[model samples]
Target: MNAEGKAGGFAPGVAKAEGALRALFPETPLQENDYLSKKTGARVFLKREDLTPVRSYKLRGAFNFFRKAIAGGATDGTFVCASAGNHAQGFAYVCRHFGRRGIVFMPVTTPQQKIDKTRIFGGDFVEIRLVGDFFDDCYRAAHVFAAESGGMMVPPFDHPDIIEGQATVALEIARQMHGESDARIGDSLVILPVGGGGLASGVTCYLRESGEPTEFAFAEPAGAASLQQALVEDRPVRLAQVDNFVDGAAVAEIGAEPFSHLQDFDARAVHLVPENRLCATMIEMLNIEGVVLEPAGALAIDALKNYAPETLRGRTVVAVVSGGNFDFERLPDVKERALRFEGLKKYFIFRFPQRPGALRDFLDLLGPEDDITRFEYLKKSARNFGSVLIGIETRNRANFDVLTQRFDKAGWAYQDITENDTIAGFII
Candidate 1:
């Protein structure tokens, strides 16, 4: 079916899909958030898809895909998927729920926390295979294996059924908004995070088909803005490089099926969030709301920063909190990124004279509020000079400016390497 024809039937189809999903778990909450509302000057609500059994909305799509496949009496009853994150857990959960054997192919670089969770969800019903280092490698391997084994493949996104399944989120949003006294979805703006575009595309298509005058915005990781690139180029294009920090949404390319539904959106409507800046949002939610959000999960909420408070004033806005499968082990990295993004932390490489009190002299240049977080002697670069790596944290960003002026006056040969991606990647 054509995209338009498929979209025409989405309202009823999504309603049915959402009804069937209740057998597995109740609908996720759509709660009003005062913290966000006050920050943006908008009446903000959060569609909490993070509360699902697999801690992601991926479960809805996986369940619907399996449910339809079983009903159609197709093949030998085994299903397969390739995912390094949320989709794998969702697929595994559905596999066990349906009592069907399944195979999950994940990149070998996937964190053990995610791998262990997928296994626990699927239990004995699913077998996991660690494939290559990247998702594309595992994806190709899964397809070849499915072809040879005659097993059906359940895609992470891209398939029509998966899109329809994800549309249920919007279906519930519309109903829930109506129940909240005089709140109409038609007058609201919905913000969704874009990865391969399943959730965003599905939600937008369903809401559009419902004949609501709803506005929409999209969020994508700045490091992997595939949907924004597709909107600009008028076709889905593979990104040359992707930062996997936001692993759940760092798709190299937007899925063709999802792009078809999303292509008409203006590139301006899509906000590209920096990976470092996203960490600040995650920490904000964690500390203030006691809400844990994975990097990709925080995309929608972080995009709110792109809007001026006056622009969103008095408007009803909904931001989808997509997932919360955070591994606590990454907290230090997250905190480091957040501090850097906030400009309160920096790193520098200094050429220090191999003489007495050189370290004391450098320390004397620092502001009262500046604290040395890291200091290491890399090597003796010359007979009289050694290379020292120094990290500093301060109460204010302006302190760095004063410190840099002191470095120049004191005749210190130094390179600010905080923003140097290559150097920071290697040494930080």
Candidate 2:
């Protein structure tokens, strides 16, 4: 397809996206982040899509697709979309703006906050359908609904229109750099977080076409490295098992349309951010910079650790902060995971003597910095020995090393299962 045919607009997809998006809101900011720069020894810029009204870049594509669908005479039927988060919100907002009806299908497990927000946006113009327990199930239900109702289904990031629309982010990035572009963008390294590969493909293709000579790094959750898996096999491949911790960017497979533009990118360019480390980023950004990032939004920020200090020093770089749809209820879990990842916390099944002063003796070994977070007796083995679950937190990570050393010297029998997910998940 020609450029216009592929992107569904005359002025190029990015340009068309820019023109079409003005009706909704101004472009997201491209601001230099001082805190990251200080820590990385590089000039750090943030593509602040997280500050959007819908708190995501998903709105850009949703708006563009809605405009084109209407222009292409798709107004006769209600627009349908399958999404639980930002995409659903964007679609609902666009549907209302155009005075068109929309049908949104979400996983039944979707948080109430998202469902409430989507409903609020669509108002009388939309209908919410809780379909399946997973995304694929909801997607299938959405397609079925569209076919049965003669409505068009608006994809989250797989469609050409969506890619072209999402490419507008790069256009805004270019403008924000005062036209000098990213000579200082840290050797043209733009770290992007990938979900269905929409933003990465769109931005990379635009920058390359503009002859920006930039380098692209893609970060996906370790649980869902769709782009990496796709590049490894030379095609999009579905993952049998996925960890959905990074809910914003966890996809079983990269979208075929988005992957086409990204096919040439090396698989090595993709970085998988650990789910626990991502939790650390979320907590750090919130506490240090007042930036609230969801797991997917923290991807690019977490990738900063992958580069050497010399590689990024004095060079300007950009990390796309994707979304901020974080629920407050998850804060404790986030903190727990972050502490565990940072080695400030540990869990073990310690063998304890049921003799008198046994607990007192163990407490005497603990340093002033050591605090017991959890203590439980699992089984009554005998009068001499009993199984106990113990969690210890310390002010310094090294303190745990000292504490454990003392335990070994004293002939303490304990099994550290802190890093064992199977054991931790079941008990903790």
Candidate 3:
């Protein structure tokens, strides 16, 4: 069946929401990228949602939510939301714009950059409270605060109004693609990053409802594959643990409301991007295109690597760049991760003899291209031997193979701890 036939009833509401959004900000540009196109053999276009006034498409939903709430005679004029990243900034911006008092509950672990930006956007109109270390913790706190304080809770996702707001991105995409002439929505592939599933569900539902024959793909952080797990279990389930490295998209659970819209999608349509690999994409975009992208912003672009050239060749592909609220303070960590993922850097723990020539013997085993980046004598495990922590960097990945071979031949007592998160976390 055609998309419009199945989702026709949903299209008009999305279109209406899109029309309302114009009063707030102009449509974000959809630019065709030569770099990505050349790499993937596709006519790659980036829907620059990162260029939104709040540096993410999140404000669209928040604005729509506030508009509907006010129109519905919500006289309290108070709003509450929980977010550790883009959603909090969007909610704060909307609250300020509407001149309504707002309370934002963010995780205590949220980056200072996000916290400061949220405060700046809201100004005196919003109050930010640091709750627990993860989003779910703050989310529960926000709910309790909303009920006790008689405030309307504006969820990051999982609400009809928020979904409608986010669907406006699809409306804009359709119109923009039509104007491009060479890009046809019917023949395009749209890649969206999934967090709580708001952006992905909204964009997919809208395009489907419009009866466009557009194909959809989703990108999710590998450490927080909530949407993928949901598809597998046939329901939303909270993860026992979540890695917040990709803090913007590190949702522990997919929202039930968003999952209802996304449940029918095939599991193959989703790509889980490794957190370290995502760092490489972020670095690539920054260095090559001079584009700054947050981890979540790079998710869709990074997922393009998972597609075979044959699948994307001759097709127009649209990947949403979700946000660019990256803090410069995190650059060192990003570069470190990128190097590790690219196999150009590694850490090792070595047991070295305390004799005079022991250090010289180890240094002699290194390849010409390999450079020592770190060396520290951890402790003397025995009277004649000491534990040494070493970090190495090389221009090529093959250098590590050669170096390891040399170590094995020389009978060096060393353990490669690069992949040991537990050990690395404690010392490296």
lDDT of 1 by residue, 1-428 (tens): 32323655777777778889999999999999999888888999999999999999999999988888888896356799999899999999999999999999999998899999999999999999999998889999999999998999999999988988899999999989999896899999899999999999999999998899999999999999999999999999999999989999999999999999999999999999999999999999999999999999999999999998789999999999999999999999999999999999999999999999988998899888999999999999999999999999999999989999999999999999999999999988
RMSD of 2: 1.9
**Model with the higher TM-score, candidate 1 or 3:** 1
Residue-wise C-alpha lDDT for candidate 3, range 1-428, written one tens digit per residue: 12222464767777777888888799999999999999999999999989998999999999988887888898565799988788889999988888999999988988788899999999999999999977779989999988987899998888878888898888888999999867798899999999999888889888887788999999999999999999999999999898988888988999988999999998888999999999999999999999999999999999999988898899899999999989889999999999999999999999989999888888888888899999998999999999999999999999999999999999989999999999999999
Off by over 4 Å in 3: 1-8
What is the C-alpha lDDT profile of model 2 across 17-95, one tens digit per residue? 7977988889898888899999999888899999888899999989988888888788678899999988999899888
- Superposed model 2: Cα runs more than 4 Å off: 1-11, 179-187
Candidate number achieving the greatest lDDT relative to the actual structure:
1
* Model 2 error, position 139 (Å): 1.7
- The candidate 3 region of ten consecutive residues with least summed lDDT is 1-10
What are the Cα lDDT values of the candidates?
Answer: 0.93, 0.88, 0.90
Which regions in candidate 1 have their CA more than 4 angstroms from the true location? 1-8
Q: Tell me the TM-score of model 3.
A: 0.96
